[model samples]
Target chain A: MKQYDVVVIGAGPAGLAAACEAYQNGAGKILVVERDKEPGGILNQCIHNGFGLHYFKEELTGPEYAGRFIEMLNNTNAELMLDTMVLAVTEDRKISMINPRDGYFTVQAGAVVLAMGCRERTRGAIGIPGTRPAGVFTAGAAQRYVNIEGYMVGKKVVILGSGDIGLIMARRMTLEGAKVAACVELMPYSNGLNRNIVQCLNDYGIPLYLSHTITEIRGKRRVEGVVVSRVDGGGKPVPGTERFFDCDTVLLSVGLIPENELSRSAGIALDPRTKGPVVYENMETSIPGIFASGNVVHVHDLVDFVTAESQRAGAAAADFCRRKEQPGGEPAVAIESGENVGCTVPQHIRPDRIDQYAEVFFRVGRVFSNSEIEVASGGRVLSVFKREHMAPGEMERIVIPKKFLENASGGAVTVSAKEAKEN
Target chain B: MTHLICIICPKGCHLNVDEQNGYAVTGNGCPRGAEYGKKELTNPTRVLTSTVKIKGGLHRRCPVKTDRAIPKGLMFDAMKLLNGVELSAPVRRGDVVLADLLGTGANLVVTKSM
Candidate 1:
């Protein structure tokens, strides 16, 4: 049984950043395992730009962003294993993996970072009522086919669910000489970023139909068309509002789910909202020495945020390896979502383990204008942050200073959003 | 007045451009948004990203992007240029495939090494 100071799973932006940060923080004998033949993971297939705005401070394509991190990891002494798949991860930090070169092996790690990332929600996951057809694919699958495999998925298309990927593909398909008829969304508002909506849809003259869904896919062996219908406020399809689109393909981009089979098998507690492992401020899971970060914790819109988060997990994992003990023995301050807030990361905070402030990331329940986000403890407001516009599509963050929690009475803090009062 | 969303950043500030008043912009979060509003009304430009055919590489397609934004109307013509390009393996990132793309003074550069 081989032993390592730290073992990071997946070679995406998250794992690459975590391994590099851990190495920089003095962790020794680090190993990064990836199932793919190459590094960079999904970013390799994401050929578009609009990444690395926050971290690299330059607008770069997905491959370029991941390339920078790959360069950094190559500069470190950490080992990288490509074309390897992890079989199981035990609660005691034992990792079982297999590869063509290694066959089968187990390794013991002083600390493990779960950065398996996330997967796209497919047609089966959404359960769209349609005929089993050959012309249907997840937006990501089509993206991989067109960008990486050098194949065109369709010539005429109708995209369901206005997520960022769907919006991006609308423009991508158009640029590739494909006619994008429409982009349909069940929700009243798009789940993608506003910039994507404008640059991808409006720029290409593709029609976007909000509060609509594909009720039926009309095709036998290959897709010939689709029937889209308007949905009511309850998200149910309304009668007499069905519209048909003549197309050869349909792309679904509903949502993303954090891949957490290994975490669940390890008996790590999972959050219902995030469908990922629950973690503290330092990204440590319930099991000591088991840290999780990036999309394995929650779906993030930006790779830059994922890089920042994985760096924190990496630094903490290195510290754990050095201390060789459990985290601080202080009662963790529970963080809860309140009115108009969907969910929050770092479900709790250990005051003694934190520095000056703890950054709480969350999303709003709906679109809000002139809104105020308030953090409260013991029925008293601790901090208030104002925003000109807030939307469910965009993740929000607020930092809580240590001074506010020093004398706090309750052991929990609530984060809520409300309309700002007019002066 | 024309209402437009500033696609310069993720913030997506809503800007109202008064074309009648020399494209005076309002409701922008930064100077870039104001500049974007003016340029968008005058001559919109976009940095196009796409994949071109590659030979003897890890992948069949290599990703590329324009070094600088080009005129938006020339996107299709620029893509047409990519259709005729087939690069060999061992291409490095930042290597220019085409210089002064479509006379827009922007070079088509590889975004990933193949």
Candidate 2:
């Protein structure tokens, strides 16, 4: 079996960034295994702009944003094995992989970084009660067809979710001369970024039906139309408010689930909420020398955040390779979600580990205006962050000063949101 | 008065622009919001990213985008112009498909190699 200092799974934005960071951080023999025929991952299928506005400090398309990283990858000696699928990953840092060229092989690694990214939630997950049809497609699948294969999905389309991909596709299909009837959402507010809503839907004069869902897909072979109805607070359909749209296509963008099959097989602890591997301050998983980042850990609102985060995990994995830290014996506190906060990433943090500050990213369970996010250790508030608006669509972060952790009384840390109390 | 979401970043600051008062901006999180508010109300523009036909490539299409933002009004025409273009394989990233497209001073460039 061949051996490497570090092995990163999935050469998407996360893997690429992580691999590059590990190599730069002085980890030798870094290998990036990718299942796709090429790098850049899903970004290649996403041709719309508005990416990298934070990382690159410029508005760029997905390809442009990913191209920058691919260009950077060229400058590094990190090896990328394209079209190679990792069949299994072991807890002790061994990976079983296969490719048409290499047949099958097992490679040992000093450290492993999981960056498998995520997959879109299909119609089955949401259990949209309907007849099977040809025109039903996931938003990502339709994106690949239109943007990459240059094939239009349908002439008239109705999207089932207000996710960023669905909203962006609504605009893409419209630009490609297809008529997008409506973008329906179960939640009252869109799950996509505000900018996407304004530019992709509002700019194109497309109607967005919030608090609505596709109750039934009406079609025989290809789609003919759909029955959209408003949903009550409990998400049950409100029958009388059914609206029908005659369309050939129904794109589902319900949600994204972190691909953590390999993580489970590796026996790494998983976070129930994020559906990804649980990690500590350094992004190291329950099993030492194994780290996870990006969508493989939790879905991020922006790819730029994935890039930034994976880099940190990459650097930490490199440090793990050099230091060869033992698995999980250190004193740490579990950081959990509370009140309005949906879930927090890096489910645990080792106090006084000394990284300047610890960044905990999470999403709110719902929309909150005029609110403040409070980070509490035990029963006492350590820090409070004020925001004008917070929504489930956007990922929020609150930095915990090292000082607070250094002074912590050694208990679980919880992040919660509340309406600002009048002084 | 017009309210706009600054697309400059994920912060998505909401800006209210008084068009009659030199596009005075409010509710911005950063300096870029002011500029976005003014330009959005005056002459809205956007970066066009899409796929163009490609020959002799593994895939039938190669992704392309405007090297810079162009007037939003010209997006349809710009897309129409690309419909007439067909490039062969070996098209490198940043390669110009159309220079100074639609006289907007922004080149339509390939964002990836074919």
Candidate 3:
């Protein structure tokens, strides 16, 4: 049995950042465990730009974003175990990791940070009524194929969802000398950032079919074509609106689910909304010593945000190892989504602290323009923010002021959205 | 008449400008729209990203990013400078592609290693 002061699982952006934080914050030793041959995780193949807009102020590709933190990790006393998979994490921070080179090893740590990112929602998850053909690939898989393996996924394609991956792939496929017939979006609005739509589709002249869905995939050995139809207000396929496109491949970018089987097995409570661990203000889970960040906590669209969140988790884990408890006083309020709001991250908040601001990340349930968002507890509006428009696709984030968090007496926070009155 | 714009949301409004008055907004969809529009029209800016050329590599493009936000008006000039850049291979990620982008006081950094 080996031991370290902190064991950071999955050496992705979050994992790497957390490890660096723990090391910088006086953790005696830190071990980063990654399943891949490389430690970059999804960022390794995310060759597109749009990352680091917040933290770095410049647009970076995924690998670039991950690399910045990995560089920081190299300067620290953090040890990395690549090609090693963590088999399980016990309640007391015992981690079982395995790789062909190292076999199996159990390490006990004073603290653990779960940075195991997320997995792409596949065709099976969506239950898209289709024949399992050779050309059906998750957007991420297709990304790996094209970006890493240096292979063209298809000559003509129809993407299933407008998630960032699919949108980027549409542009990538086009750049690779392939024809992207169209990108069909199931919802009334795109599930991607406006900039993506503008750069990936609008600039390239790829038609985006909103409120439409792929009804069936017509393929045998490989993809031949697809049957698409428009959806009604209730999202039911309109019978008379079936359209077919001759295509070679279908890409699914439905959504992302946090990779949290280990968190679940260790009896950590999961947030039903996020399908990830229910974390407190410090990114600490219900289990005291276990902390989570990045996609494992909630799917973050930007790598910059992921890095920031991981740093918080790492710093908190280090504080935990030093026996420094976050002074607990006031009960936190549950943040609820109201109206066009989807859900918020850091589901709970601490009301007593002077620095009580909680970074609330959310998505609009639908698209709206000229919107007023209000944060309130017990019928008193705590804070109100205005936006020109909000979309279901792009993730929106705001800071809940320390004053509001400290003043709320009850253990609940509600965020509501209303259409701005036209003047 | 403060031209309130809502770039925060997708609604990019062109409000009638009257900074002389006490922040009165027109042509906005919501209250937030008015506030954002006022801020943006008064002090308009945005985040910028563009790629620098890489030399002696199979990968033609190694993405570069700003270390922080810059004025939106400087974007075209930034792109002009970035478009003329060419760096050699063996460039690791986070390497400084352009140390300081034309005195914007912001560094243009490589995000991926080619």
Q: What is the TM-score of chain B in candidate 2?
A: 0.93
Residue pairs with backbone overlap in model 1: none
lDDT tens per residue, model 1, A40-149:
99999899999988898889999999888889999999999999999999999999999999799999999999999999998899888979889999999999999999
Q: Can you write out model 3's per-residue Cα lDDT over A227-319, one digit (the tens) per residue?
A: 999999999999999999999999988999999999999889998888899887778888878999999988877777788888988988888
**What value does DockQ give for candidate 1?**
0.88
Which order, best to worst by DockQ? 1, 2, 3
Better of 1 and 3 by DockQ: 1
Instruction: Give me the candidate number with maximum DockQ.
Output: 1
lDDT measured at residue A292 in model 2 versus the true structure, 0 to 100? 93
Model 2 chain A lowest lDDT segment of ten? A324-333
**Sliding window of 10 residues with minimal summed lDDT for model 1 chain A:** A324-333
Ranking according to lDDT, highest score first:
1, 2, 3
Candidate 3 stretches with Cα past 4 Å from truth are: A324-330, A352-356, A421-423, B1-111
Candidate 1 TM-score over all chains jointly = 0.99
lDDT of 2 by residue, A16-122 (tens): 89988998899988898999888988988888887887788887778777888888888888888999989998877889999999899999999999999999999
Assign candidate 2 its CAPRI class.
medium
